[model samples]
Target: MTSADVTRPSPGRETPATAAWRPSRVVTVPPAVPPVTTGTLADLVLDWEREDPGAVCFSRRDATGAWRTAGVAEFAARAREVAAGLVAAGVRPGDRVGLVSRTRYEWTVVDAACWFAGAVSVPVYDTSSPEQVAWVLSDSGAVVCVVETAAHAAVLEDVRAQVPALRHSWVIDDGGLDELVAAGRGVGEDALRAARAGSGPGTTATIVYTSGSTGRPKGCVLTHGNFVDLAANAHAVMPDMLDEPGASTLLFIPLAHVLARFVEVLCLSVRIPLAFAPDSRELVADLQSFRPSFVLAVPRVFQKVHAAAGHKAASGGRVRAALFARAEATAVAYSRALDAGGPGARLRAQHAVFDRLVYGKLRATLGGRLTRAVSGGASLGEHLGHFFRGVGLTVFEGWGLTETAAPACVTRPGDLRIGTVGLPLPGTEVGLAEDGEVLVRGIGVFREYLNRPEETAAAFRDGWFRTGDLGSLDEVGNLSITGRAKEIVVTAAGKNVAPAPLEDRLRTHPLISQAVVVGDERPYVACLLTLDEQALAAWGQLHGRPGLDLATAAGDAAVQAELQRAVDSANTSVSRAESIRRFRVLGQDLSLENGCLTPSLKVRRSEVLRVFAADLEALYR
Candidate 1:
């Protein structure tokens, strides 16, 4: 059964947040996914492995300077054996299995086994506090928990006494799986039969938690129908992207996030290899090893790569730097001119010049095989987006939340808009509320937040899921996300402003890093910024302000003023009411572990409210 079989469309509604952006004429929806084959996702893995051996499905870097991987067929067989081990340990169908770990080889093995053994996967962020972990363990009613490292083991053990449902806790990579799986030796009758019995498309597959940028994280339960169809729909949009039989997707982003997990399943189902990046530090080498055709990453990765290229270009004399700058912008403009539908001989000549001089160098750093990059997780700086596209990289921005199964609208590969987040996926319905919030509905949409029926009911009126994001659709069907409804800051003068646009402007300044605007119920916009460590390092050398580290640089009067200048200059582009009048430089950088950022690297507003309560009060002082 598909999601269509599980829920019916809501009745016609009168009032709604989004008025529904009706196309001038109805466009055909994308194809609904093919029916899911029986026997679960594990079956897909086994089938691929049997076909190819050197084909590595999952690989990672070890701390001792080497890469690791499991064979295409070996990977599946291990998961089968792992499932047998779990069943012997008392795991049963409909059981909730918590994967409490960072992305690693063992994490994949255990997670895959959970699904094949007829268990529900509960993926939690690795940085979660002990108390938060306990809450998830109890809330999800998990029967088995897979701990990543010794650190995770300690955390889970602290709460195991309180969580009675947690019967079997396996510490992956702790030197135990080999012996345990051997003891189970071959598939047990009960678990093997149970695994073969299988589940329908509508059965619960996983419960993914949102990054909780708005408040405490809420769990969104997605079934086989919600996710399997999304994977198949993704294939339909760019059918040729994953055509190579031995293709691999380098898994770096945290699997706890819905986007990464969904991509993992899609790759497996489509018969592509999955090479897990060894660790965060070894990502570059991992990328080179796999030579991925497509990569899904956040904007931060592109920003860092872009910054590195700029530094390389600046190494030459003043004349060389100026020439490179002129060449780069000309290339960007030339490319844009072509994308506008018509092209000229003069534009082609300019493009050829930059392609030889600058774009070639940048492409080498990216390993040269990357065809398209899909950026999501948060709003990308518009200027940064333009910079990447200009450098000859086609970056497609997609829109969705954990609640929508991670995607509602994605810009098509052939047709892309630099500033907008592409068109709605085929087979999905996207419209704007009368008030302008994005509303989405279709087979790809999730059933509801796990157990919050009231919130679910409130979220839907006439079948549309309220996105809480504000934006308008262009004539060609691209989505432009302008701001969030809840984050609108009002000044003492009663003028309202959306921080995202202003924040984007501020980020364009080379010295400024993360800009978190604080003006809600206040007189004007104020911000807390994390200075770009690399840029600040360069600035110190140029200005003779010596500081070896970021913290020391933060206190250097000259460095502090340089950061202030970037902020002040960005403020100049906005109206007086929306501009930041006063700000403070933070000595300590905002971090995920410190409760300053979400797992996706977005600033946590409530945490900012608490940690910087004194700094915020001083703005009004």
Candidate 2:
């Protein structure tokens, strides 16, 4: 496609102009729900309690591994009690209360409680280090902190001196929530009502810090309206997924992340039963036990599921592996045929056989009732997208950042497209700059960065917020992210290369965990790779070499050949100039512990380049 061709969507399939919009450069979707002019996030719980006291909104696992359910009335009463506790403890209106916890029942209650008390909540990731904890607390000026564990409380103690505003801390594992409830026994009902009524839709709700893939994490100031309006609009557009009877979800992603945080409110707004899996080690068990109808996760999680299935099949022996491979290929073909009209009779038969033999088991792994999933944070790529849909789980890819209050655009259920991240949400407009940078303006868009007026001003151009990510809109207005403009690598020969597509493709392979494509000023494209330890162990055992370590496997002939095939497959998608010419497999994997990956799992590209400089230089030599 020529430059002009790539700039515009297909000839006649343009989306209706809702703004003074251009064909591909800009597109807008009219709001399906009316703008939220009144009410705070606190009211979502309170209104439910008043109207549907017996409605089941949350399900949680107890210490004995039993699942327990909570109704709207119980949840509302608990939130009120927690809010009263905060008030009794001197947490005044608009005060910042820090919450450091994993995804759990109490985390949601605390989030609601903060809003009930008319306070702004600051969520800190449980995995965050002491320094990160210090920065967020000190910067946000949190007056009180509620941590999930004694270890986290200890981390807070280390930073207590730095954050002079933080006067007290509570540890939930030690019955801190119970203590809070007890302390608030004498608090008046009128005080709780007044606190809940103090804030309107425009009042600040939370200060969510960016995952910081590049620089220091900045606090994104999201308002009550951003969550309330966005959730209402999202529900309006996707009622089949959100408003259906028995619609439920299992949230394993960290609640500190903006996407999961928004999902917390989205589920509450729609009155869907939401469950949390705080420990990843227990995620599979949780999925099976909770049996959610729909779920949400990043693309990496989907990729891991697919890879694990493949590895499991391989472990069962060659014949089983071949049958599974054929089943996977048939699934991809069947899904593609669906887009081309419908599957043929023979393809249908093949899919039916596989659904009975292989697909059913895979679906059972995620809970037999899981018919749909929502993917964000990164691209799912067309390969995994089709395979999962083919296997009976439709994964909807969404696109957004912390500044957008989660989703600016998300694929709809019936109108789904495999490769693209669907149209802008209702009340949202998306545009591409001349350089292909994505710009967004919507109900979900955040107000500003905390205490960074100049940076906030620079983040917006005119009225649309500059997303800094390159993307293109398709014929049907589905948005496909190309790459981050900042991460683009220009070769020594002056050819521009977008590494994300290639890296995403490489990660689809079972043995690869992370792929960092580097060649900014080098002769040609090259890559620094890290292996998936779990997949590596499984792959090694299947290859007659048990007890394999990353360092030894980096030079293993079989490993090199397998990775080479994966690389060669990725190279087929790009021009010879942009293709990866060489790659180095590191002895160690990049991780959050080493500061190479953000909490959201995006690679710190500059960090990778710095830490692996010698590897890149060796690739050229």
Best by lDDT, which number?
Answer: 2
In model 2, which regions exceed 4 Å deviation?
1-24
lDDT by residue for model 1 over 1-621, one digit each (tens)? 012111223212222445553322221244446545444665667677777756667666667756676777778778777877777777777788888777767777877777777778999888888877887777788888887778999999988887888887777768546644865676665656666476756677888877888766777878776676677777777665677545557778888888888778887777676767636676776677667777887766776676666555544445555666677677567656756875488777777788788887677666677756788877776667766776777778888888777877777766767778877676676677677788777656777776678988898746667888888877766778988888878877888887887787676665666778888888778887776776666555555554535778656777667667877777777787788887777666678867888887877877877987887787788
Error of 1 at 489 (Å): 1.2
Pairs clashing in candidate 2? none
Clashes of 2: 0
Candidate 1 segments exceeding 4 Å error: 1-28, 32-39, 46-55, 62-69, 186-190, 196-198, 244-246, 311-331, 341-357, 548-576
lDDT of 2 by residue, 1-621 (tens): 112222222211233335354424677776787678888998888788888999998989987989999999999889889888898899988999999999999999999999888999999999999999999999999999999999999999988999999987889999998888889888888897787676888899999999988889999999999898889888886888776678899999999999999899998888898998999888888998899999989987898899889889877877777888899999999999999999999999999999999999999998899988899988889999999999999999999999999998988877888889998888788888878999887688888999999999998766668888999988777889999999999999999999999998998888998999999988999999999887788778878878877978988999999999999999999999999998899978998888898888788888888888788789999
lDDT at position 579, candidate 2:
98
Residue 126 local lDDT, model 1: 86
lDDT of each: 0.72, 0.88
